[model samples]
Target: MMYKFLFWLWLFIWCVQPKQSIAQTLESTSQEFLIRTISQVDFKQLIEKIKTTHPLIAPSIEMVRCIAPTLSVWCVRYTNRATLPQFLTALHAFPAVTDIQTNHLLTKPRGRLISDPLYTQQWQLVNDNINQNTLDIDIDAEEAWQINTGGYTTHQDTIVVAVIDEGVLDSHPDLTHNIWRNTHEIPDNGIDDDQNGWIDDVLGWNFKTNTNNVNNDGIGHWHGTPVAGIIGAEGNNGIGISGVNWRIKLMSLVKGQDEASIIAAYDYILTMRKKYNESGGKQGAFVVVAHASWGVDSLKAADAPLWCAIYDELGKVGVLSVAATTNNNTNVDTEGDMPTTCTSNYLVTVTNTNNFDEKITGAGYGKQSIDLAAPGFNSFTTLNTGTYGVFGGTSAAAPYVSGAIALLYAMPANRLMDSVKAAPAQTALRLKQCILAGVDPVAGLQAFTVSGGRLNLYGSIQQLSAYYGLHQSASILGSLNAYPNPIKEHLFLKVSLTGATRLTIQITNLSGKTIKSRQLGTLPQGIHRIRLEMAHLPNGIYLCVVQGSAGRQVIKLIKK
Candidate 1:
């Protein structure tokens, strides 16, 4: 009788409990919601609500099962080698194929490959042993000098730097002011007001969901915010870490963990460029410096076509793409990642260096592909929590270079376009020069970097200021000109050798290593023409230094 009573009591308690769907329970609580199973009605209703409330959300509802279990399959597309009909036939033939679509592609498998044990050990040491104080080499005073003495003044004209990563924390105090504004679209209007391929790209577009909700979900990996901080954190706000160019705008393009998503983001950047050019709205020199931190270890030639196409597209419209060198410590020349190996003249491939300013052990090395190196180990930068934290990777280092480029471009007003256009080569030359001009000889100039040195922001800015200022006055001393700025096969240099007995033609990038050196047999009096055959040269910027018996003249050249 007691057992029967207990059973009846248990049944009563179970029946009286709340009868709510998992969605309702998850929606009403603060815990993370993982949608496992949904009734057809609930799923349809949820999608409809998303469409009505968040019109920019373009959900690719179809699911595609992957061979790997841990990988989150998003979307799949047909490769160039396979026709649509063939792909469809294959999909129909295979029972394992759950779903397929054309809007996006699945992310590469997150495979663990053999890494250098020594480098991995070193990384562990850096990760576990280093602190903020140890990593923060006092650059505040030097940074101040660059801003003040180097003629680095904050201009009201804003430059937009697109952070193509996971997403951004829109509410982050340090980043809010710098976020890009979509003036054409009204918020929550459920319309593509801008009509620029995105509905409401107010804080920037999210290609992951093909939506406007480009907010940091706090769990999707905090890649974008740190990158954003490196580029344009609010300066002099008495807040967290300062960005290289705080006055510029920050555009957030949410790229998911897939190549197709990245490609879509790239397309969005191009779209913005077109809009900025055709609109005639602001008329200021708008520069979009995209910071891409994602890469893989495999060397696939087929991947080259997409990257090559994107690279050419970026080059045509004067967009600078800065990519992170893979952290695999492998030789990039023999086996490199896409986009970095795209061989585009406009793309600036950067590797990682440590606090000691030494090349990070795991950082990818390439005598030909990598352009420069920047501090990446134990890097102290802003996080999505609106605070500062320590993170390290070639990923972190790429943005330092990207931010420097933005700052360099921000210096000149009327010549902003030309300045940004000339930045890659100048940056490359500066890196090369810094390495060559290093204090230690045994460290060996070439051993430091491909360009052969660390990133010197102050020196590069000083050089740019001196170079462009002279051009403004119509003076020949500062006007070192190169023809076919984007040189395909040959680069011609026109200069006036005024009272110079011997001239040494030195080509270097930002790191200060001499890329191309030629001792001009002799300078014949006045206006002279020197030709450089760049048939085998990689696409990038090279600083041509005409060091005469009298003095030195530096000119920026681009190799396509």
Candidate 2:
């Protein structure tokens, strides 16, 4: 009876052990490979040919999907570790394959983490002389917030900003209200509901793990949640701290530290923006700006031209990208730095500044490369633990710029919204101009940065308001109108005022050369029209700038 029992036990053990070992073996051997094919190659046919021709790797390898379908880039998963070289060789033999590269791991750049004794207040936004902070040395966020708190455009279109970093803790109390949700997508249904190629991407995409779980709780990934909080943490709810914008939508794009992963992440952003533009705000997300807080130092544009070129593509589609300079306190222009060095007007590069309104010792600076500085040292922000903490670095600085852009979009300006609808590309560049031109000149940054100043949120908002003929209050320059835009002989001007005020009209050429100027003395609270002779002016584009006692406006005119 004992011998019979022993035999039965041996048989039971033998039956289940191989199944467990096989599962472990498959998990251990799985590897990801990114492949770029020529434009004309048929993806499905090529994938099948590779599988059938290389029989040894047939059962172990599978095509994941085309990440950048427009670019013919595909990611493949191979579980036959022992036959990886054979599979690669077979792929190389195909004439359609352009390039093959394995995924490269990357680590986030570390900023100087100095603990401040007083972390209770966000002096970076107001700077009320706390902790020896210089009075009024902050971003003037209070004044800007009073003008617009940010959530949707004046046209009532929801504003969304993409945070391309590790990932965001979307469920955190302070962020839950502002987190972006794909209403078309059904959660955890094991199906591609929207058919955007990603499965169950209700929140956002995770390029690192190729999954929809963008809420990363990994050790170093703590960077993303804080960054997101700095851009759009919910405000006035009496909970935690408020971000630059209290009510803007934030999208998470989780990425690994690799060129391919970064490109894939951006491609996802490009895809969404393109869809929005094509669908007339019906199907896709309206991501106006994207923020990246991580970059590699000493990397040049020559080495990553594709990455550099992506900025231009984004700009063409009316999306601006903001990036952080390396925190090495080095001259990025000479030593070289990615992204910041990319000469795309659509790209805004930011360096770190302290509460004293001075550049930090460990932050990067370049007179021509770095655009501006922001309060990045010891600023209070949300943490991944569903709590508040002091988050700083150039990482913190970049979001201030992004939030400013989103805030500008939220302004209730009819002309501003009209311009965006008419010429999105030009409007994007104009926003960049507002940011660079409205900076508060800082003596410490004068010789080290392009703007030679720190960010002034109020000033930037004012610049946008002036450019688009918008005022904080309706009492001054209520409306401005210029007709017969392509004037052949006469250009008519109409001004609407809420109260009596003097008005000045200045017409300048595209090169900013003043072509004409007129002073229309004080007028009562009503609409008035005036005509100007334009028969002698050469054929070209011009700016009709109108200024009043309390506000200003600009109109575009074309002379025929």
lDDT, residue 543, candidate 2: 84
Cα lDDT of model 1 by residue, 217-238, tens digit: 6765588888887667665565
Residue pairs clashing in model 2 are none
For candidate 2, the 10 contiguous residues with the lowest summed lDDT are 107-116
Local error of candidate 2 at residue 530 (angstroms): 37
Task: List candidate 1 stretches off by more than 4 Å.
Answer: 1-156, 281-285, 413-448, 470-560
TM-score of each model, in listed order: 0.55, 0.64
List where candidate 2 sits over 4 angstroms from the true fold.
1-120, 218-220, 471-560
Give the Å shift of residue 103 in candidate 2. 68
lDDT of 2 by residue, 255-301 (tens): 88688989888888888887777887787788889789989998987
